[model samples]
Target: MTTTRPGGRSARVRSAVLRAAGDMLAEQGFGHLDLAEIGRRAVVGKTTVYRRWGTVAALVADLLDEMAEESLPRTDTGTLLGDLTANARLVADTLTDPRQGPLFAALIASATCDERTAQALHQFYETRVAEWAPCVEQAIARGEVPAGTDPGEVIRAVSAPLYYRLLTTATPPDHTVADRAATAAAVAAERGVYVPAE
Candidate 1:
């Protein structure tokens, strides 16, 4: 039995392949992705790429999983507003980053056309929202927001407009926009907007 060690050759190959894939996705979008081309760019064997990830959608799914795993842990700022602001700023910074922004745009575009990619994208956001949901839970415990405020909804609200702006407008979301998003979400949560219906 061949066991793959952590940080071993297999790990290196996966890292290289993922990096090459991300570069390609950022540069040319999902339509141009080919396993053979990815193999060439990653300097890995073509067969290996095909064997590991059978389809472009599968490869993209793996990439999204990797991204979720590598994402930063949530910030804890004591106050709900402060924590939400930090979360919004993180999303804004990621969406505005040169390499990551285009890569995400490509992924989101592909998701619209491919069911598997869409599932992967949905899972990515779910992971991100779950990570930040605790902030709202903390707020509830602190009496900052009404009881029964949906933590996940509050977290999603913080990022929704930023993503809308990313998709609909040329202007990238900035810190000021992030601040506004956080504030709005916080105020809404405080007013029971995120609270579940009776």
Candidate 2:
């Protein structure tokens, strides 16, 4: 027996459609994504997919929003190096994962040509960066870094090289890569690279 309840049904439909969209985005790239196909894959009605998202870009934006919501929070490890290392490793792992690697690449590529997608992608990064920025603030409070150092910049620095390597090369990042990124960012922050002069 099937029951039609507004809240439960709508939420499940959204989840299923987003999952289907994510799978297609990962497997075939965003260029091949289709509303009708996503609806079929999700077992949702085509009209619903069309009515809800209207376009592929909108659907992808929603998927990115969901991804941000589902991403992990930061870890606190008493030391800046430890915390940054954990953050770097998390980014490395996600960018190297079989499904996520391609999915992210596709999204990044899409953002390059589409303004709305770019905004959505930027929002996703902003959310992730904000989640980890507190670790840098904690480090500053601990006298590990200079006062007024930008925590968001420090966090971004830790993950930038890892992401660059992922986008530029076929090789997956190892633990050493994550460690190096964390160390480099920590050293830079210590040297005031992220500190803005008044």
Candidate 3:
């Protein structure tokens, strides 16, 4: 049972391949992705790429998993509004980033047509939402939000409008928009809007 170390050759190959894939996705969209081209760009063997990831969807799923694993942790600001503001700002920053913004757009476009990619995208958001949900839970404990407030719902609310703006128009969500989103979500949560009714 030989095991691959974290910083070994295998890890390097994975990183290079994923980077190439991301660049291609951002530059050319998902329809133009090819394992052979990815291998050439990554300087890894074509056989290695095919054997390791099997299909484009699988490779994309792996990339999404890696992204989820590497995403920044949630901010802890002691106040629900502050924490949510940080979360919204983080989402805005990523959506407005040159490389990340286009990459996410391509990924989302692919997910719309590919079931595997859709599942992967869902998992990615679940991980992100879970990471930030504790802030809402803390708010509940502090009596800032009503009891039984759904932490995941509140976190999702903070990001939904930002994503909507990013996907619907040419305008990127800025810090002011992020701040407003956080404020709205916090206000709604405080009023028990996120709490599930019986």
Best of the candidates, lDDT: 3
Q: Candidate 2 lDDT, tens digit per residue, 57-128?
A: 888988888898899988999999999999999998998888898899999988998887888899999999
What would the TM-scores of all predictions be?
0.96, 0.95, 0.97
Tens-place lDDT digits, model 1, residues 1-198: 112334888899988998999999999999999999999999999999998888989889888888988999999989999999999999999999999999999999999999999999999999999999999999999999999999999999999999999999999999999999999999999999998888
Give candidate 2's TM-score: 0.95
Model 2 stretches astray by more than 4 angstroms: 1-6
Clashing pairs in 3: none
List clashing residue pairs in candidate 2: none
Model 1, runs deviating above 4 Å: 1-7
lDDT tens readout by residue for model 3, 129-197: 999999999999999999999999999999999989989999999999999999999999999999999
- In candidate 3, stretches whose alpha carbon ends up further than 4 angstroms from where it belongs are 1-7
Displacement of residue 66 (Cα, Å) in model 3 is: 0.8
lDDT of 1 at 136: 92
